[model samples]
Target: MTLNASLLKQGAACGQEGVPPPPLLLSLLDSSHHILCVSHVSPDGDAVGSLLALGSILRAQGKRPTLALQDEVTSEFQFMPGAEKIIGPAEVAHSYDLIVCLDTSSIDRIGTVYIPEIHNQIPLVVIDHHVTNTLFGTDNWVDTGCAATCQMLVRLADALGVPLSEEIAFSLLTGLVTDTLCFRTANTDTNVLQAALRLVNAGASLEFVVRNTLDSRSLGLVRLWGVGLANVQMEEGIIWATLNAESRQRSGVEPHQSDGLANFLVTVREADISATFAQRFANNGQELIECSFRAKPGFNVSQVAYSFGGGGHPPAAGCTVSGSLQEVSARVVAALRELRRQSVDGDSG
Candidate 1:
């Protein structure tokens, strides 16, 4: 169980000298025979991509690896190589030699797949790239400076001596591309581009991954966007939209289909922060508001999300709050405005 103290990128000095040494990450994988790999619920591309790529890497070592996700993979990501192999919570095994959590920030992010009462006894390794990571695993490899966890895995494969195969290359490249929004994110550094290039050289099609991920969207999502944008609100540099049950029903879209709205709203030139509030119903039939937030480079929404029991990077974050869509949206928008005010004040000072 080792924790990397800093970033781990190929060709750059990681400067990570933590207790138990960094090589133990590989040792954990090598010593384990049967492994369980899981990612966050409502997995984005990075989550699904990292899960599949890790399975391929483990299989290369002749180890049996099972990939599990709390929810089903979206239609757009179903085309990813080996995506059909991903299992749901019910299909997960009772035991495994080791558990690898990828692209997940905390234990709860793995959702119902991890029953802490029994599974806590087993060794756990967390591989993620988020500033808000709780470092819940026995072995935590959190590289906040890295753009995506998939980029860190590129260096991990090099250390483990696993040559990038076509399947692995496709999966890893998709994670890199989607997380960085096809290299349009603020964190798209030289290291990120070089990693994408290496993956492309290893037989991944950049254009193909882009077309399937960033360039594609469902018609339902477009309809939902139309509903959200019709009543978009802005105040003190914070712009936001609320999607209640009526809005969703009117647009004929589900909750998951409303994801890209926040990303779209944040593009407004006058808005430094943007948010999308979607209404949801819990299993117990209680109302829950799912809040997705985005920020410009100088504004951070992660801490605000963390304050509300959610986690993500500085530019993008989210949370699930219990309240009506209007209540939650108003509260979160006020918080975002304050955050922007403080950020601007600090910069001026």
Candidate 2:
């Protein structure tokens, strides 16, 4: 089914009523000469994929696009076309016609890579699928029910009549597969499948995307998982693990190695939620902890993440707590207990 002009108008009207805008968004493209595309720190596939795909889309429309990351890109994604073009916040300065932040729900989550000086000087556009999105853009497009930002971008392309090129389709498909865990997540719907079909017709190769993304794990990552798994602990049916900077360095593990390990702890028979606490020793002597959380269906990890200054989808979300790892872990456990109590109270009430 082709998206008609009236349907597009209705979508824009509905967006004014607070619905997230369609994925194939072109409103920002009008007269914007230079655009900055960004993703959050420790970016998963969806975050990076959305930025790259959208950057490509912007480039195709004759806009100069600079894909920026608040932090470093994972080794796994370094080979993606246009990935090498990502510039640091300091290097770019106040040079963009518009700054688009993707997949990140909040500004703090951008970490040290995106300095306040840079963000304060630019017009911001936020695009995301996280339920905890704060609408922190001069223009915001957030679809909590959407499986991934890439999925939203595909719809945006369709709405704006941008024919999906092979590269754009492949990049978007990578985001969909990575964010949905190859469609294992409950967010996949008929529309999502139809979007995938369109992308395939546009020349996306599922086999190539999966091979490059899922099957590209390194031996260091495998060993890092072994260490993390060994540290797994169970508390009241919740499985948790802590990976300190020392252990990570000794294992020669990079940040990417720890990406999906926390979700794997859900394999425990009694586990309802799984969490991982990763601490980085700072040279400046401030404590910072990265907390990754994942819950089984029916759990709202987004709420859990928000309580501690983070956000994402219900089943998958995370936050970084500014304290010692032990302190953050304790707070997370307490929050989970409170969440369970609230659940029980709601059920009984």
Candidate 3:
């Protein structure tokens, strides 16, 4: 179960065929005895999956890995293996030989799970698939072409000479299915499917993953969507909705449940871009808006997200802004319209 870093330098399948992890990434894994693995705040399946999968992989390497997240795993993804064991920032130890950030675009994206003064003192490794990644880790292996960070970890397991345990396969496949919307995303290429296939062959159940994640939601979310969709607005091929704190309380929905309302808006036939602005309170309890966005295959939302100090893929991205829900939604919708205008004009040009 103990693998050598030299194998990574030899260019093994650890990173898939085209996306190899840097040897230093593997060296840290080979060298570090205790590791901390974390994903983003308000984690989606990809974030939680990558975090859990890394913990499983590190354990296989005979290393102690602490899995941490800034937010609780939503009900939809709690079915995934090991989701219950993930820790919060307060539970994290003050010392570790290494920290591996997974599926997070930037250091802050991991929330307080990464204490800059403490965990930052350790050698950090970043493994992510988001183009907006800041390369914050001391050793970074960012594969933007990989559909999900879980997909990248598959390659990492191979490179590390570890077999895919059922726990690993189940965790990774959850990310692939949710991030790609059951193989329907624009980024779902043959390689992604092939990785999924291998995971299934290794004993992960595709039906189980799909049923629990993509096909399931809490009734609270359904109620929140009702409130969100009722306020939907459209302008110049842009669609948006606002879920203010009042509406959220009336609907009895958690902030995370109110998300994906943006993704739901883009399904409108007349819409080319979509956004949902949901209200949230920071650790200091100041109200802010969390903007989630989605665009059709040919359009790009990442640019807009990056412009707002956030980052994600072209078809999906987001940012956090400070203002009333109404104010933030209005400002963001204006930007979405401009992005749509340019995307349309560029297509015709």
Candidate 4:
């Protein structure tokens, strides 16, 4: 059976059973020339997992795969497969025949400080699960309802008739577990659970992946969390925290060390919405703030983030704001306020 035929059958069964089946993206992969896979800046679990897993598949098919990143992978992502193979933006000179951007919603969010010599302005293949995606790719596979890009990749693998190896299954599982918050997110559907089961059956050790990704943290990261939690400010049911460069240095933490800080704010009982702003003061005298946004069901944080040049899913999304921490924080706070006010007024009407 063809890949599309297999996926269509699975999708039909899922629909009949009222399950949200993952979409297949492998059809686009078979035609890709030189593949460039990228993720968002300051990579997270899903970002790392999606890129590596997909890159592995491309290599399996004998395609020349280059995993490009805006910068080097942080210590956190060092354990993922293909981490060492990532080429920084400065080293990217060959025009990609096909660029597969994973996890990132927009081209700018791919976070490459330097542009590549993309030949023929090659077609982009965007595979993402973020609702905020702008459909920037020439060929796009976006299933906003799916839990993670890796979940989507699993379905793609099945379509391609490729058996999942332990390495591939682990990478895909890591993305699903982290993005779903260990299956805590609202979008965690029955099909997603089945995908997890399939990964486990294929040799993915869920317990190990979970323990390492979430349970392991450095002392610096723990201290940085305290800094984030301490600075947590709540206003009109919105909670936010700002971690500036000075605070990061003082806490002996790097930018990505505060990775889960925004989600931490979401646990606050009084907050319907939460965000964490990480400010990096570069030695070159330039500053940029990374904004991470999270919200409960009724709030549309993705739309709010997209307004400021960032995008993600409705429940979790982020954008990078340029300027000092203070400047960006004020702008973000104001945007959230406006969102809340608009929501409130909509309810009244």
- lDDT values for all models: 0.84, 0.75, 0.84, 0.77
User: Model 1 misses residue 170 by how many Å?
Assistant: 0.6
* TM-scores for every predicted model: 0.93, 0.89, 0.93, 0.87
Clashing pairs in 3: 14-155, 14-159
Candidate 3 total steric clashes: 2
Error (Å) of candidate 2 at residue 114 is: 4.6
For 1-349, candidate 4 gives per-residue lDDT tens digits of 1123444333334223233323434545676657778788777888888888888877778888888788677776688777898888787756666777888777778876325344336656667777777666655666776788898888777676677888899899999999998888888999889989999998988899888887787788888888888878888988999898887888776775575887878888888889888888667878988888888877889888889888877788887778988889988988897898787789899
Q: Per-residue alpha-carbon lDDT of model 2 for 40-84, expressed as tens digits?
A: 878778888888898888777778888878666777877677778
Model 1 C-alpha lDDT per residue in residues 145-208, reported as the tens digit of each score: 6788888888788878899998998999999998888999998888889989999999999999
> Model 3, range 1-349, lDDT digits (tens) per residue?
1223444333223234456888778888999988888889989999988888889888988999999998898778887778899999889999998888898888888898888877667888878888788777776677878899999999999999999989899999999998998998898999999999999999999999988877787787888898888888888989888888877877677776665787778889999998888897766988898888999988889998988889999998999888778787888888888888888889899
The TM-score of predicted model 1 comes to: 0.93
Which residue pairs clash within candidate 1?
Answer: none
> 288 in model 1: Cα distance from truth in Å?
0.9
TM-score of 3: 0.93
